[model samples]
Each structure stands twice: as structure tokens, then as C-alpha cells.
Target: MQMNEEKDSPAARTVAALVARARAAQQVAEGYDQQRVDELVAAAGWAIMEPARNRALAELAVADTGIGNVDDKVRKNHRKTLGLLRDLQGARSVGVIHEDADKGITEIARPVGVVCAVTPSTNPAATPANKIINALKGSNAVIVAPSPKGWSTCAQLIAHIHAQFDRIGAPRDLVQCLPAPVDKASTHELMRQCDLVVATGSQANVRAAYTCGTPAFGVGAGNVASIVDETADAELAAERIVLSKTFDNATSCSSENSLVAVASAAEPLLAALCARGAWLLGAARKAELAQLMWPEGRLSPAVIGQSATRIAEKMAAREGAGRPEWQAIATARPSMLIVEEDDFGEDHPYSGEKLSPVIALYRVADFAQAADTVRQLYAYQGAGHSVGLHSARPERALALGLRLPVSRVILNQPHCIATGGSFDNGLPFSLSMGCGTWGGNNFSDNLNYRHYLNVTRVSQPIPEQVPSEREIFGSFFDKYGTA
Candidate 1:
């Protein structure tokens, strides 16, 4: 397919094309009404089409990229879609999102014309679907720029969306994807042209979006870490860690990069993890695992998202250790384990986020040390995101919440699952989470349907009534102060 040359130029013509489309859609979209938009979105066969979408995305992803498993990708797609829809159902995006009778004012929702969304390889289908749904919710037209690794899956998703739009008689151009690789030039052009850009993926893309001078909502890198102290349930904590680390092969940004355990509970936690199919490697074994993870001092794509057995076999073969006992290796589960003393801090080769099933373990002298260790980890990838703690101490949990730069703090739960979902946390469910201050965004968003749309305030001046000080004091102060 021939890419648009208008996307090549950083001139007013490029901006005009996007603006014209938005202007045209705005007139038609506004006439359709919010209820109509909601009805179309709800009955668009999207929910029913979710399963097929997942399968298609997985098939195309594996065929094109040779990365990630079909089954895992399927699970990711389903879970993300379900969560995204659930969060969007009751959101008051159209009529009155907020109303204040006291001030005689209402904040009516208005669409921000055209939204340009950039998706990542880690989550192509879910991201595009999320943006499309959100833009529709607020009656905004959207254009997508899928990453090179995400092209096939994104194209399939876009096709499905177009099919839905066709069935509903919605405008075809309401949701469009750039029919080309999202190189720096094209992306920069798109960013400059669109009314707003919601970017979720690489830091490079985010920086470009920001530099384009358009309103941009972008996320940063994640190196999330968790802590389990003696006050916590070692068994349950261990199990949660394993589940989170291995969930979708740890592609989630909230997946624990390191587990800092107090020395008092370290042995018991390790044993508990072993009972739950985790293979705890000793000092020398940990070194071997690290080599496999960072071969030639870089992450190996082959090892990423592979089973523990596969990683162990590859490492054993590379070491020429004569196929280190299949039974021992099978029982040994090397992908997730404790690292040696050599790899501890920012200098540690594996301290950052690992997309595969691997975690670094650290033994702290005390609860203070555990908290300190967590602080150091957050320093590597600061707040505006989240932190997980497995302590029963309400005080410690609260303390961490206050101390950490992060916005959301998950307690005694699987960080990966809870971080971006609505099951427990009140936050909206999303695949792309904004890492607030530490991650350098205004809020830590799960990139729900609402994030894709912008709100415009419509205000009508109301006559002001001055209240006497006595009345104001009587209404509030007397109810509490005098009582």
C-alpha cells in the first residue's frame, strides 16, 4: 500500500488534512448524539468479536514477529478487552460527567476532534481497540500508528473495527490506521497534525510526540519491584509473586523485577515458592541463569517469554555441561530465581524490567532495609506508577504509599494483575499504564476508553448569591466545631 505523502511533510497541509477530516466528522458526529454513539459502540459486535480478534491477533503476531506465544497472546487480548469494556460501561462521558446544583453549573462532555493514537508491539490489539472505543465514547475520530512489530495485528483489528462501523452505518474514516510503518518521520508528522496524541510504548516515540507541540499523553519505562517482610504471609506472598512473574510471560510493566525479602522470612518464602513450582537457584546456578538472560550483556529475544525448562536447557547446552540432568533441570525452574550479590543495584545487569519469566531476589537485614531496598528500586524507575507490598502491617503499607513517588500501591496482591485492572483497585482497567511523576505523566492511567477522548467545558454564567458569614459558619462549622 502506498503511504500518504502528506504524512511526510511537516507543513500546514498535513495539519489541514487531519483538521478537515475532524471538522467533517464533528458536524456529522454531533448530530448523531451521544446515546446513538453509545448504542452503536455497545452493539457493534465488538464484545462478541473479541474472541475472534484475539485469535487473529495472536496468529498474525506470531507469524509476523516470531515473538510471544499464541496461547499467551490470546489470554492477554481477552483479559485486556474484558477489562477495558467493563471500565467503560458506566463512565459518564457524554451527558453530565459532573454537575453542581449549588453553583448552577454543569460540565457537559465534548469531543476534541481528532485523536492520533500510537500503539506498541507488546499489546497491539488491546491498545488499538482501547483507543477506538474511547474516541467513539466521546464522539471523536481517531487515527492509529501501530509499531512495526504490531502492524499485522493492528491492521486486523482496524479491519474488524471498520466492519463494525460499516454494519452500524458509522463514518468509515472515524477510525483509521496509517497504512505504513510508523517511522520517526511519519509519526512526527502525525503527532503534529492530530488534535491530541495518546502514545503508549517506546520512550523514543513518546519524546517525539511531546516535541511535536501537540497535547500528548505518554508513558515511561517500568522496573517495578516488590517487598515481602516478616510481617507478611510468606506462603501467599510467594505464590502471588510466581503468578505475577509468569503471567503472560511477564510482559506487563507492573511485573515484579525484584523481590526484596527480610532475612527472617527469606528461607520460608523461598521454600513456599518451591512448593508452587518455582525453582530457587543457588549462587552459582543464579549466575548461569543471568548469563542466559543477558547473553553478551543484552537480553536474548529467544529466552524472552520461554518456559523455565527451555531457558535451563539452552543455558546448559551453552555451558557444554552435557545436558545438565533433565529431571534436575525440570524440577529446577531457572527462569525465576534469586540473583547473586554481584547484581544488586542500578549497575546490576538484570535490575530493570525483564519481559521474560525472571526475577531478582534480594535478602534484606530488616524491615528498614526492605523499605530502603524498595526505595532504591523505585529510584531506578520512579513513581507515577505503582508498587507492590506483601506486608500485613497496615502502617507499613500506608508508609510506603506516602513515601513512594508512585500513585497506586497494591497490597498483598499480584502486582501485574492488579496494577492495570478494576477488580480491586478503583482505577480503570487498561493495557497501557501511565507512570505518573516517576514515569513523567500527569496521572498513572491504565489507558482506558476515557483517556482517548478530551473534555471541553461548557459554561453559562449564573447570578451569584452572596452568603452571610454566619450562614456559612452555621452550616459547616456549627455541625462540627460546636458539637
Candidate 2:
């Protein structure tokens, strides 16, 4: 009786209907050849990349979600989709992908079936579009479960996708979203019913995806701390960091949350940042900003992803205290605010991901101290996501990659654009960045086409070429006298 009741619930029924259509669509997709799959992927990409349609989606995302501006969203929709399509140009996801005579094995690619993608409000259009493209490239169906604020944008994007699918004679149901009443219950049901879940949003959603009784891929929190060492060109480093830190009001999880500058370069780097319209808050102003941002022990929604001017306005209009001394500060019209701090962890709120046009500045004695500071920052939050290094010396960048618990070490570029694949860099173009074991994620690389499919290896009998015990442990025996 309980099982029947559970199945008949409204959330369950909604999810069942969506999943039924998706599974049917995926069954048909299973027969498509690589060329057909590629065509479908192209259709999906075009649906989002078309300039007028992209503009509409971006505007709707900003108007509905109030997380980012339309201009940046428009650029993001174009570049991210274009980059992903470029990455998928010659990639194969169907039929035999590998054959090795020496190993007597053949590897064939297979679809992962219907996918449930839970996307965040910050990236209503781009995130879902990327997931849909990847799913179609693998000949799978995708159903997006967008956040409440992102529902309208996602619905419109899916409508465009369906129209494109109609033109291409593909199944319209192959890409869909949870309709009107998008609640947690509906998303939970969708996650439970799908073959796999790819969640990119709040840690709560990622955790739920992991526990949803399905194979899942989810990203982690980002508190990216970039190092500006003595060897770095201070002007260039400041220019790139400011550009990244202020993009889309810092909605990206890959955006820099903090900066650790070596003492020798700190002055010049800070001066460059100030010249680029970054305001350095005084000690009292920093405390006020912190209170305004985290009044109830959590980041207040009013300033979470708002622009620096908006945040400044909020700071100036403190509740009962009529126009505090910061009124003149607010008039500066800064592009971003800089808060210098020496501590980290829960008690120090600035140490974690800010998700806005704000940067915490830390000064260290040298490169070694900067590295140690980064390690401590990770210990507080954002382990295994990524870090940025601005230095003339390539060895310093390499050392950070080897020493820190991070997935990508972005070198001499804007951390946000470089962490997720860039045209100039080799990282896969993606919005979802898995932070590995350190951040409780399954992957340590950027999410890409390869994560959307499964591969089967067929082994044939071959002459064994086993190594002798002496050959396997020769050095071990010589040094430690193995038993």
C-alpha cells in the first residue's frame, strides 16, 4: 500500500511521465551512428548559440534569477557552446572506438541512457546547454532539473532545442526540462528515476545527487586563491585577475575568491588593481561589509551575486544607521572591493567562496608562504577545485600543481576563463569542475563529453607475457630484500 501510494504521488507522477518519454527517446538514439549523433549534438549547440536566441535566454536568466548581467551571460552562452562544439568536432562516441592487436582487445562506446541534470540559477542557460550537447553527442537523452529561479530560462531553452530537433527530424523528447512546478520533490524524483545524475549547483544538491541511488557526477565548492609572486608582471596579473573577478559579478564558481600576493609584489599589484577601479576597504568598512554580506551566518541574497555598485549601495543604506561614513566610499563606483585579512576558517567568513565582485587580499612574505597560505585556505574550503598562479617562472606553477590538493593550476591567465577550458588552454570547456576526493567529488577534471558515455572492452585470448618475480621486484629485492 505504501509503495503504491508513493508511486502515485504528484512528484512521482511528474517524474515518471518525463522519464518515460526520455527513456523512449534514448532507446531510439541507441541506433544512431556517430554521424547521426554528431548531427543531433550540432543541432542542440546551434539552438543555444544562435545570436538572437542566445540573447533572449541571457536576458531571461538575468531578469528571472537576478544572479548575473545579460551581457556576460550572452558572451558565456556563445563562447562556452562554441568551445564545446569545437572540442567535439572529431571525437567519437559510437561504435568501435579502439582496437589493439597486441592486447587482443576491442573497446566499444555505449550510451549511459537517460540523464538527469540539476543546474544552478547562476548559469541557467549555459550549464544545461552544455549538458544537453554532451548527452546528445553520446546518443543519450537529457532532462534538466533547474533551480526555481532558473525554470523559465531552462523552459525557453528546451523549447528552442525542441524546435531545432524538429527541423533535424530528431526526437523532441530527447532534451527536456521539468515543467512549471519545479520543486525539490520533483527534482528528487527525477534524480531517483534517471540512469545517471550530473549536478552542478549548491553543495546540498550535489550531495543529494550522490545519495540519489544512481550513478552521479557532481562538482564542489570553489574558493579559488590566486598567487601573484614577485616574478609576475604585476600590471598584467592585476588586469587579468580584475577582469575575471568582476565577470558576470563573479557568478562563476571558478572566479577568484582570494588573492595571496608575495610581499615584494604586493604593493605594485595592489596599486595596479586600484588603478583598474578596485576600492580597498578600510578596517571598519571591511567589518561593515562582512556584516552586510553575512548577517545571519550565511551570505545574504541581497549581495550574493550583485555588482559592486549594488553592493556599495546596500552598504551605504545600512538599516537604522542613517548613511554611515561609507557614503563617500560608495560614491567611488568601484568595479570590485578588496578586503585584506590574515585569518581563515569558519570564523573568518572572507576565507570561503564569496560568489560576488569581492576579493580577499592576503599578503605573504614570499612564494613559500603564499603556497602555505593557499593550503590553509583550502583546508577551510574549496579543496581540489583549482588555483591560479601569476609568475614568469613556470616552475612555480608546476610546484603548486604538485604540492596543492587541486585539480587545475591556472597559470598566468584569468582563473575563471582558464580553469574551465579555454581556446588558448587545454582544459576541457565546461562549467562543472569536479574537485576530486578533497572536495567530495568523483572526478578531478573538468566535465566533458567523455563523462557522458560508458565503454565496453572485449578481450580475446592472447599469448601471456607475464613478468618474472625477479623482473617485477628486482630493485625492491636489491634495496630492501623482499620476503
Q: Over the full model, what C-alpha lDDT does candidate 1 score relative to the true structure?
A: 0.73
lDDT of 2 by residue, 167-270 (tens): 98999999989987799889988999999999999999999999989999999899999999999999999999998999899999999999999999999999
Q: Each model's C-alpha lDDT?
A: 0.73, 0.93
Off by over 4 Å in 1: 1-23, 43-49, 295-300, 319-335, 340-346, 458-483
Poorest lDDT segment (10 consecutive residues) of candidate 1: 337-346
Q: Score candidate 2 by lDDT.
A: 0.93
Model 2: how far residue 483 lies from native, Å: 4.4
Lowest lDDT 10-residue stretch of candidate 2: 320-329
TM-score of 2: 0.98
Report the C-alpha displacement of residue 374, candidate 1, in angstroms.
1.1
